[model samples]
Target: MGSTHAPVDLSSEYAADFRAHQRTLRLGAMTVWPSTVQPLLSRRTAKLVRCSDPGTYNLTLVLEGTARASWDDREAEYRPYDLHSQNSWQPCTVQVGQNDQIVRCVGVEIPRNLVALPRNSADRAIGRPLSAREGVGALLAGFLTRLIADTSAYRATDGPRLGAVLGDLVSALFAHTLDSGRELSPEAHRRTLTLSVRSFIGRNLHDPDLTPSTVAAAHNVSTSYLYRLFQDENVTIGALIRRERLERARRDLADPAQHGVPVHEIAARWGFTHHSAFTRAFRAAHGTSPSDYRQARHQPTSIPERASGGTPTGSADQVM
Candidate 1:
């Protein structure tokens, strides 16, 4: 599916009559824009938001300006390209700068079941403004941009998959924010630990020796608890390791620089040791043999044939 609506001109269309012109568009179960306006937001005074009904969570991305956002008596200035999420039910104010600013944001109403934290949790999480500068924030920004760009593909049938992506992104962002500040609680600690473990696993994908015992020891947690941590994520330790390793191999194979590297070496670099075993795994994962993949990447027209007797593997992609 794709968007049929023309690009919106919020500045001219809703510049005046702020109350009636506030636009809200539903994108799947989530709402994309709720009462968004460029003019109603300014730097001179704090803008108080009155939701039609209590919303779950308000996700905002700073498209082209800087401003300070305040929730539950805490505040922080957000610069261009920064992303922030807030609990909409709580009374909050956003202060913009003197220059006209443009912001593109999407707010997702937090589901009832996930909001079962103690009363202070929301306050603690939103009280101090959170910035999406790294980790989950970086992933969330990319995911949300992709989501909004391809709304049709993220329909009812794809809800579960999309929801999982959203959950992981948000979990990572909030967990990072809470841990960096002094306000993290016991529950927050657990959530942050889970995200950290996942991130560590991702960064160590090339290490063939990465294992449950290694991960558990790195985090100073027992093997049983590490398994338990991933239970809620619908995956196991072994599953994550495999997924990361395969993903890395796929990326390296696709790189033009690797046109000469032997498939066996590529596999070994990412943990696979045996030539036959790596070929089988690559075929199963990518539906193509490693030699075929290399040949396809180095088609005669795309890559010049080596002069004399130089092996293709002697080029950039090969192991020295």
Candidate 2:
């Protein structure tokens, strides 16, 4: 590629048979690319930077294989699940893949100004491999993987919102990596914390013990602060937990493979240990009892379909 903003020289021992694949998603100002490439070496020279520098930063999360990157006299090797950053203005070299193995990675590109961190701190992070296996890095890595796996969950209008979320996660991860968490803007901190809390909730939805107090304690936040976070989103923490649980149970009820699974079992699977309580909650949300909802979905095709189509009748309120 020869564009000044994104120029690089590529070489490879398998040049004649080199292959690469990438699926890119552009959300507002940020772009994500999940890619797989054969063993190769790429270099960005000073002359290329002088031609034009877009003042962008690239964050790459290695999903497979081994690679090395160097910039500003610093060099580091990255293995699977590790992350590294690159500055567009810096001259750099990246050697990716090894022993005929293909390198798989997810790359995120955003304008430098979008990252809420000191320029020097951000620069210092370049070429240093960051661990994506835990902490904020783990959250960012999981978000990136899920975003790529199902971009369809979001609508076109969600581009800017999704981009902003990505930026917040990146900034939080970088700040944590630099031990500058206190430097994050108040808004960014709140957003990142909220995201972390939500992720924790999703992972523990099957635990009936999951609650606002437990969630707050798990994240080292006060219950009041956690309530404030959900208040900002116009939802109660308790309600969000119940909603997620009900949704999971509803999904299981509607799945044909789960037909043999009893309604009470489905309810228990999603944290609803009380059959009566589960029935009332499911009815309130879906407008049908669990047993009825399951039967309706499993009805013969010859049955006259309601306006809700395959969805159970009275559950038209459900989001498509």
Candidate 3:
């Protein structure tokens, strides 16, 4: 990818090797760029080559620090944890701050065909900010962030599977931004809900009150409906929540920094209420009590979490 850039200050031609790491799955790709001061990447009309690969809708997620983007008659500001989508075919400029502010992000590109939205509807959404504060947006953000942070935890077999999930997430997110004006297919609708439920669960992991009923209420769905949705996955919503909570607690216990935090406190931090109940659950889940698990130098690992996807919306493939 021979991409070129110019400094925002117009002081001179931009020249800097910014520290950016990128990874590509079968259907989606993620690129992480550490914060930098200058050399903003610019893709103008002269650069969106017609002979390149099909264009995609790329979502730039600002994990840390603030940044900005510009494209076809539009400009958008992004801060930490903000997901901003743009058309890969459209020319754009992405700029970040200087001073080693440490801006890091994972970009997910969604193929246009996979998005299932009208061209105009899709166009209307470019470069707009999608906050990871609540709803499906938060869920997708968490999934993408986790995927980038723990890519090694995923096996080759999980690629296509995650891609499909990523597509569903993108559809849901697009629909969300479109409000009720947009229509999602039956399958996309169900999947969107499932991902929403999953996202809800993830966001509220610390809340002991995060139950199926509460989650259903948040999404305006019945508890039974929510249960049915996750039923076939062989993972009850309760089980998923418990699994996530336990996993989080287990990791916290394993951390030497958390050593001073008591076992009961740690359990409660992840939603466990009763000390005995928490201890029992911890022991049952990890084959040892939280206290012992924390004290032990190397605790036996448990099951890893699953993943999700997005698509390519960048690179005309030439930028020397």
**Best by the TM-score measure:** 2
Best-matching candidate per lDDT: 2
Query: lDDT tens digits, residues 130-234, model 3?
Result: 887667788787777666554545555566667777777777777788784246667778887887777667778989899989999998889888889987899
Error of 2 at 117 (Å): 1.7
Tell me the tens digit of each residue's lDDT in model 1 across 62-160.
Answer: 655566766544667777557655664555556543344444454454542343344355445564455555565766665656555534333344554
TM-score of 3: 0.72
- Judging by TM-score, tell me the better candidate of 2 and 3: 2
> Which residue pairs in model 2 clash with each other?
none
Q: Estimate each model's TM-score.
A: 0.59, 0.89, 0.72
Which residue pairs in candidate 3 have backbone atoms (N, alpha carbon, C) closer than 3 angstroms, thus clashing? 2-319, 2-320, 3-319, 56-313, 109-311, 109-312, 110-311, 166-309
Per-candidate Cα lDDT values, in order, are 0.57, 0.85, 0.68
**Residue-wise C-alpha lDDT for candidate 2, range 11-38, written one tens digit per residue:** 9999998899887677778888889999
Q: After superposition, how far is residue 45 of candidate 3 from its true place, in Å?
A: 0.6
Ordered list by lDDT, greatest first: 2, 3, 1
Candidate 2 error regions (>4 Å): 152-155, 300-320
